[model samples]
Target: MGFKNFRFQVVLRVALLVVSIFLFFRLDFKSQYVGTQLALGILIAVQTVWLIVFIERTTERLIKFLNTIKYDDFSENFSSRGEGKIFDELYQRYNEVIRKFRDVRSEKEATAQYFQSVVQHIGIGIITFKKSGEVQLINNAAKRLIQVPSLSRVDHLSAEAPELAKQLLALPAGQSTVIKLWQGKERIPVALYVVDLVLRGEDFRLASIQNIQRELEEKEMEAWQNLIRVLTHEIMNSVTPISSLAGSVAADVQDYLEAQPGEQIVLQREETEDMCMALQTIEKRSQGLVRFVHDFRSMASVPTPKKQLFEVQEMFRQLQMLFQEELLQANILFLIDCRPEGLKVLADRQLLEQVMINLIRNAIHALADQPNKTLQLDAFSDPDSRVVIQVSDNGTGIAEEAQEQIFLPFYTTKATGSGIGLSLSKQIVRAHKGTLTVSSELGKGTAFTLRF
Candidate 1:
């Protein structure tokens, strides 16, 4: 019998014996008193031993079940056979808990698998980082985006693209930044979205990288389209009047030539001279138009740079010679503060020289009207492993509104300027794996710095 049933039977026997003793004592039954007392004592001893054994077995089973749970054996279920009635309900509850846990574990595994699949298949780059910014996970797309080396880990992106990396790292939680990264010869524009995520009470950042090449291309096309429209308008304005004037002059000359032989020779000669002058004016205007078209086309057809190691000081000396006459005419003081020896850099010599010429010419122009005009061309090496060349002029500084658009194509502030020089120079510098940046303030001279 089960322990609970055996305990119950023992209790019933004790009760019966106690009642028999009571009856014997009350009805002068002393003769049976000794026997009844002895029987009750024996029954009490046997029941005590049985109760101790049952308690020991029950405690042992409970300890075993608890140990099973501690070892993560949630699949094991306690059997009800031979167990006390008190433990039957407890066993059933424990089994139910194990079943629920199994279901939950299965669901969790499925969820993890789904996320893994998504991360692997997605085209965009995905990276996860811990709160301390240590990389936790990166997908194939992320590797491709950064051009990660096979043997190297991307623990610090700042080392690769310092300016862009700093901007990204400074972004607050739930914020994002877009940066342009140079991969070899191409500029890849990427948008980074930083998101804060909490997992098991710990915080993390999930960075999603999206390639914005198409968007950048669209914006570039739009800019070129606008430039084209402006150029077209300007060309038509200058060409139409010249064409009409030339046609009118030709017809007038033809009519005069066909007039009667001796009709007012002096007056006809005077008229002929005036017509010839008018025709020359038309020719000059047309020639100017042709020159403008040539210059514009030349600016548009800038060639890709073929980079080589060269001395920057040599380039500067050549520029100084080329613009010596202009400098003398303007009475401008030209100063060169380049290294006494040489500053070496990897760049396209021809393109670099073009950029320098454009900058120096602009500086000369700026100082043309200044009372004490000075143009300084300086070159030095920066601590960041870059060669910096600065062109500064003490002249009428750029206006605030025009400074921003100074580098844009066909955006000249000068009344008699073509406006494509600075833009083309910037393009050339960029093509040589360098940066051409400008900073200026009204009433303060402008400075253009080339970093290589």
Candidate 2:
């Protein structure tokens, strides 16, 4: 209402000033009325100046309000003390808008802080980086998961998970993969996922990683243990008694068969011979079954790795010497190469050698049927500084169906295979916190890769 009154007063004041000007124009300025005319002129000029000052005062306040918002100056306070109700109401509106802005800003800041805390506290690791691999953000969970104090780039992860660094960079948006890694002496299987982000018109990738072995494999391993226990218990129970009985009977039958001719006169010679052979067969089979059960038990109970740093060149040299005679007899062209030469790995040397030997032996068997056989072992450092060892063969490759189960215990394609070697080799590599991966195509070749 005061503002309305002020507007009305301004209009009325302007009309009054116009009337004074008109009167001055119409005045009869004679020598006797000169002083009166001059005084009237002065009054009109003073009213005009008063109007300008009043309008400028309101304009000045409007300008100040705009500056407050433009500069995000929430500290500004509009007070209407002793001013007319018009100015007081205007000040209140300004203050109201400023308070709203302040509230919005506070809410945004609070939201940011809340999310930050959540990211740092979550169990799953989170990493956000630019396309160039520059790390933008890494949560505390991520640092803890990788066992690193700090990471400035994604490629730095190569030292921890050999192929993880490369995989993260090349991972498609919304895709996921599992990476095998070692923490201390325990093997950890990590599931990595990636998503695309466009923020402020710049592209970025956000990756989340979690130890899947802890969440998924622990239960699976427990079930396997249960199954192994039941099998070992049942098999040993059934075979142990049979093995003892068969051995005792075989010994008694052998003694009877070797008795003097007079002692065995009642029975035919052929009958005694058949009885001894049957008892011996039963004893041998029963003993073999017992050994089979023991093999599985030992496979299930792999020891923790005792890791130490060693050069690949020296390891390859020893392998060459070990397989030298076999390669010569098989007529297989064996090639070993270790580039940039001093490539090294941290692992159990004996266990790694066992894995290599198993793979090589399998390759030799595979090449047994090939006319032109070739076996190659190459070791080098990858782009991320991870040591990569690959054993390849130009022989009859593994069948597609069989490749899937090749790493399973007691799963073998050979007639004389115990079916435990490949599985045990895989377990040994895992124990060393490494991976053994196979790629093969029938009749072309097969390659087994080890990354550490």
Candidate 3:
């Protein structure tokens, strides 16, 4: 009953089968009585059946073990009894291996559940997807940011914003892009950052999206309030002295006029003239200050945009008509090109037109009397489906130091400039859910780009 190895067990079963068959044939030829032959045949049949069962028992146990492993069923333990020493050892190893697998699986599931909870509760929106646009995971924040209850793919965003969907699909890993989303009447700015990763041998992109509209507005308000404080301080300093001086000068002049007859006027003619000159100077400076305040007010009080779809070509045509005479007189070659024929953008026509005019006017000033004066305007859509409008001119380029603060209120390099034009234009573009940027090289040219 006890075998040293698995091969010895198999060989013993085969030998028993061969001996039973040989005896069965011999008994058939030698048996003479009916009862005897019947008994011998019954004995041979029982032995053959026992040998088949014994040989098949190991195979059956192996099949059961494999099934348990496939099903991750760890409740059943392998028995190391009733078989030979080799089978006892094999069953013991199987039991130990199954126990190890159970422990590993439990730990893995616990770890996975922990990370899942963390991912779900994070503040920022997160989504993971394959290159084919199949969404793998989406957190609650992502659903709220996207304004969707369930998302299966990135292209689903096309229903709300076509450009946004395109950008999301084509966004490169390790890069970030800002997109504008409109919820009712409010516009939200979402910043998206993507990273490439591989999970279980499959490539995926993980993106984190966060709304930055409120933050930007807060910072902008803070900047404006600071500027207002400075403006108030400067206006008070200038106005108080001007008012006091005006009042004093008027009092002196009135006293001189009311002097008694024959009494030498307390104010000499020279002193009276000096007072008059001082009043004139104050008046001039006050008027200049008034103009400055007016410009600032204009910049601060930009109205909310009334958006409408308009063709870029039509706008360009209007620009040509508006600037043709001036460009011709100044001997500046002005060119406008709208690629893809009649590209259009959704924005406030009047506001965008004002921005373009400000940029072109600045270019004209830079190009004044400069040789080979050329101004170019281009309108087209970028690869990410954003509408881009560029104004480039070969003029006295913006100095590197000045370019950084060009969009700040009251920052100007020109003595006669109000410094609000470029800043106002920048605010207008930002309000329209766009960006305005500038690139310039010394003595080469300056180019301004508006992307929406």
Candidate 4:
């Protein structure tokens, strides 16, 4: 029996003993002494034995009831048979407590099972971590996301789930970040979200991860669709005028040749010569249209790159030689800062050369109107272990609003510009697994940076 039950029994026995003593004295003084004394002693002994038995039964029953509760046998009931009012009341209260506990346990189990099912079946990955940065739980989706070997204790995820752990840790609390995980040098984009969870006065974090490859692919398709639309619009604009002019010239030449007679031979000869010249001009414009179509087709049919290692300095030298005459004629100063050993990069040499050429040509055109035109080409290594090539010019720079669309296909500020150069250059750079970025300030200068 517990100490409280034992103490309660002891106090009851002491109070009963004091009452029996007082009753014995009062009865002896009021009535015949011997029989009264014997009757009172018998009564006292009977009551003491009964109280001892009652206390033992009650304590044993309470212990059994508590054991039933501990063993999760809530069906077991405390019998109130042959018990006093206090014992009956205590049994009633105990049953109520056990019933409430069982109800709560049932609810908890149901909730836990529901959550488990959701986590296991959901498409997105879900991971929960303790406040100490240790992974506490990971769903099946999460295991597949991180490529976990097996479902085990999630503690110390840094070793078992390095990629996922890195992404989760990089995310700020209550915010989401997109990260590209490298699986054997192949980048896989994943969107990660982290949020704090507080439970029972302890703090934790939950991370949800989703693959964004399909979304990005869809966006890329949409962008390509827009590019095609723009190309069609530009080609039609150029071809429509050429076709109309050519048709008109052909008809005029036919009518003049048919209406002329053999009598005015001299006048007919001069008219025939003028018509011939006009027809030649029309032929020249037609040829220009054909060349523009060819260029457009080439841009549209950009081929897959064949990657190889190439020297950067040699590429720059080749481009400089190609544009040397234009630089001289435009009164532009061209400067190149090439590395001594020629920085080597793993890329498509031909594509890289094309990108550099386009960038240089664009810079030259930008500097065409400047009296003191200056162009600088610099190649260097960045702190992030990337090789960077920069082309800068001191000319009228692009406007801020137009800068965003400059790399877009068929977007240009110059009247004579075809606008496919920068877009094609960017595509080429991206195919080489590099980036082409531009920065410009109006009236100051423009810089195009390529990083590999």
The superposed Cα distance between candidate 1 and the true structure at residue 226, in angstroms, equals 7.5
Q: Ten consecutive residues with minimal summed lDDT in candidate 1? A: 147-156
- Top-TM-score structure, candidate number: 2
Give the per-residue lDDT digits (tens) of candidate 2, residues 272-387.
67767767777687778878887779777878888899998899889989999999999999898999688788999988998899999999999998999999999987644778
Which runs in model 3 stand beyond 4 Å of their true positions? 1-222, 260-267
Model 4: how far is 49 from its true place, Å?
11
Q: Write the per-residue lDDT of candidate 3 for residues 312-360, one digit (tens) a residue.
A: 9899889888998988989999988899777999999999999989998
lDDT of 1 by residue, 1-452 (tens): 64346356557656665665565456454664678656656766666666567558767757766776677666687777544465677778777777777777789889989998899679788877776767778887777777664212234776776754565455687777787665532346798888888998988777788877556544653576467667856886879888888888878766765774565533467777888888889878878788777666655567888888887778778888998998888898888887745778888888788888888888888877779988988888864468888899888888767865787777898999988898788767766656776667666687888888
* Clash numbers, per candidate: 0, 0, 0, 0
Task: State the TM-score for model 1.
Answer: 0.50
Query: Candidates 2 and 3: which is better by TM-score?
Result: 2
Question: Which rank order by TM-score, best down to worst?
Answer: 2, 3, 1, 4
The deviation in Å at residue 318 for candidate 4 is: 48
Superposed model 1: Cα runs more than 4 Å off: 1-192, 206-222, 229-248, 255-288, 304-307, 321-340, 367-374, 380-386, 394-396
